[model samples]
Target chain A: MEILIYLTQQFINGIQLGAVYALIALGYTMVYGVLRMINFAHGDIFMLGAFISYYGITKFNLPFPILILSTSLLTAVIAILIEKIAYKPLRNAPKISLLITAVGVSLFLEYTLSLNAFFTPNYIGFPRPFEIRSYDIGMFSINNIHLIIFSVTIISLALLYLLIYKSKYGIAMRAASHDLEITRLMGIRTDNIISFTFGIGGALAGIGGLLYSMAYPQINVFMGIMPGIKSFIAAVLGGIGIIHGAVLGGFIIGISEVFVSAFLSSTYRDGVIFIILFIFLLFRPNGIFGKNIEKV
Target chain B: MRFFLELRKLIFLALFIYLIIKLVIFSGLPTDYMIQITLYSFIIVLSSLGLNVIYGFTGQFSLGHAAFYGIGAYTSAYLSKVLEIESYYGLIPVIFLAGIFTAFIAYIIGGPILRLKDDFLAIATLGFGILVRVILDNSDRISEVLGGSRGFVGINKITNLELSFFITVFFIIITKNLIDSRFGLFWRAIKNDELAASSIGVNTFIAKLIAFIYGCFLAGIAGGLYAHLYTFLHPSNFDILKSIDFLIIVIIGGMGSISGTIIAGLFWVFFIEGLRIILPSEILEYRWVLIPIILILIMMIRPYGLMVKKEGY
Candidate 1:
């Protein structure tokens, strides 16, 4: 009975962890779906979101609700600006050049933030805004933070689903992803759609960052690197261009990570994640939902 | 015409050797910081050229060269320390074996990994690099000699200015010859268009695999040399950032240009070390703020690199 409870608790923890990854993975998949490029800087953007929100709450003393809206909106604008300034000119360049530029942008964001006066190079404790409370049901226990994470993830995902399916803008995004040139020929402004896609992706990453801080309650310059890589892996595992696949892949990774740490040595946690990525790349390069396009 | 070109090349080689011998005499005997810097630059040239072959000529993106570098370092360190191999002369053979072992490992993994195209391949290799770091960090469970996070210490410092300089020159000549050969044409073709190359009856995968292995072999040799020179092995030295450093050297040197790689490697090492003298103590940590900007500017202004005009044989 005790073992079952422990297993159930770990499962819940995994779900909570997976929810954050899924949020970040959504941004990754959405951007790749439209641009066919990995925004290597996305994770650092997520870190910026959390840091901004942290400052707002602690320094400016903003409410939690206000913090979420402002952080998401701010991050969306920043993401659009990044696309315009850093990635726009490289659109016609070779794919490798674009990839290198993305890496450059990622490094720029990371090291720039680490410079003194921007943010300290040290880890800062994230003061929890709310009272700590736990609710126990039968043999398992859950926290208020866990509840918030679940509620926010489900609501955001539902809104994303509606935005992608029920809205005209979403339809335009889908069209743009399918064929940018054709969509432009059909009178839809592709540049706007591309920027909008980046905005949405950035907003989702911001939310992911906020939730992550709430759960872990700590922030650092490098907090985004591992999660960003893992979420990208999640994005790949689910099939890079597929939205739902990203979510599935994120949960699978989160759960597997928890299990590995719980059953095996915690030292193997990172190695296992990397190994999964390697195996997937070897056997199924296109991922679970991605279609393989053979070139002539 | 060919005879005159060969004579010119022979003269250039003679001048190069004379210059190196002069430098080695002035700085090599003293073994001071300047000599140490030059020796380290040679090691960088070897590794950067290795990366140049894989990414530049073969057009296969590998973000994991540092992993092979670490593998070579650890392997050599292990052979010298744990196996307790005697004889100073034996160290040369041990270094060769370590490099070969790293190449063999690269060859094995290259088959499956080379199948992925472009960005996918980049991420896969990046993952493999991280995996190597993690394994190196936690390898103490398997053996105590690895020293885990503390790093392996007390290895012999067998790499000196003379030895490293000669070895570096020998490898550069070998690579130069390889790139000038008929097989080099196939690599160039594959880089230009893999599909077209395959249609022309070239085994694209096998050719790429050979380039990858050879490049990794050079990196392994560099790593072995580095381990002995520092007489220490740390897992952190071979992380993703180190891999990026090698990539930057190749890119700055202009891909596929041997002379460019050499020049850029020397410039990069001296420039970075020079920063120590130029930058203030408080801003030392912030010195890297300019690197990414420089990289971006380079990509924007000269995507083909500084020596792009001399790319082909």
Candidate 2:
């Protein structure tokens, strides 16, 4: 009975954790959807966002909600600037060129974070905003903070779904994704759409980072790399460019990691994920919900 | 003309051998630091050149080459430590065996894993790297010999600048010859256009596998030398960041260009060593910060890298 309750609690935390991954995965999916290039720096940007939130809450004494909102907006602007300065010029280059730039940017961000005094050179605990503790039922338990994160994530994803599918701007964005050159020729301002996509993705990732710090509370300069790559795995696992698929992949990854770590050994968690990735690529190259392209 | 080229090669070989032996024999002008720098730079060049075959020329992004490096390093280190062998005599078989073993492992992963494109391959390889580290970290049996987290404490150190320089030169010759062959052209074609190459009856999968295996073999060779050079082998030294360090050397030096790897590898060596002199010991934690910033700037300014384009390119 105690085991059952513990499993249930772990499951809830896993779902809430998946929500955070889904947010970060959206950034990877968005950039990939448009440019077909994996922005390796997205993980570093997520890390940077957490540091920003940490500063806002501690140094500036800002409230949790206010800090998260401002940090998300700031991250959006910074992401857009990174795209323009580093990635935009080499859009026509081979994919490798752009990848190298992404690595460069990722490295640069880590260095900057290391230099900051507040962040220091080592790992430090982050500030959790709410005083909310866990609420346990007969066979399940969850923190009020976790519930808040879950609600915000669900509502945000719902709005995102509506915006992407129902709105005219969404149509334009899809058109651009299909054929950027043709879309530009047809008088659609593709750059604006690209910027907007980055903005939305960055804001989501920033919020995810903030929520993550609130949960884990231990922030370091290099904390984003592993999670960033994992979320990118989530994006790939769910089929890239499928927004809801990102959420689905995130949950699958989260739950499977918990089960694997619990059942097997915690050390084998990543090995199992990579093995699944290899197996999945063999069977379904286009991913779960991804459309296949017929080459002429 | 080809005869003249062969003659030039012979002359270079003779001079290199003479220089190394003379340094080892006399000219006692503090060769300790020089030996370390030269050996490390040589190892960097060797591995980076090999990686260029897979990444630069073949257009595959593999982040797990360092796993093979660690595998080889640990293997050679184990043999030397356990068997108490020296590099002077029977270590030849051990080095060759270790390299082949590393190649086999690389081949196994490259078969199925190379099918992944871009980020997928990157993540998978990164995972493999971590797996290597984890296994090395947790195993108590091998940990005593491999030093687990504490690292291999004492090993016979026979690596010197003379041996390193000669071995590196030998590797450069081998690589240059290999890259000039039919296999090299096939790899270059795959890099240019996989679809077209496949249409033309080029077996890209085999070619990629070959590149991966060969790259891993050279990484093993470097690792074998590195284990002895440092005299303290550990899992922590051969991490993902070390993989990135090799990648940076190749990229900075013009990937697919042999001279480029040599030059950039040397530069990387000198650059880090120079930093040690300039910076105080207290602020060494922040020293790694410069690497990333420099990497970014270089990517922006010269993505193709510092190599001059030859007529062949």
Identify the leading candidate in terms of DockQ.
1
Report how far residue A58 has shifted in candidate 2, in Å: 1.0
Q: Deviation in angstroms for B136 in model 1? A: 0.4
Per-residue accuracy of model 1 over B21-122 as CA lDDT, tens digit each: 666667647436666676788888999999999999988888899999999989988887766765547677788888999999898889888888788888
- Per-residue error for A184 in candidate 1, Å, reads 1.5
Query: Model 2, range A106-136, lDDT digits (tens) per residue?
Result: 8777866676554656898887777879877
TM-score of chain A of each: 0.96, 0.94
lDDT, candidate 2, at A217: 89
Task: Work out the TM-score per prediction.
Answer: 0.95, 0.93
Q: Roughly what TM-score does model 1 have, to 2 decimal places? A: 0.95
Tens digit of per-residue lDDT, candidate 1, span A19-125? 99998998888888888888988998799889989988899888888888888998899899989988898888777887888888888888898888688689999
Off by over 4 Å in 2: A116-118, A293-296, B1-14, B17-25, B141-144, B281-290, B310-313
Model 2 is docked with a DockQ of 0.45
Off by over 4 Å in 1: A292-296, B1-31, B83-88, B310-313
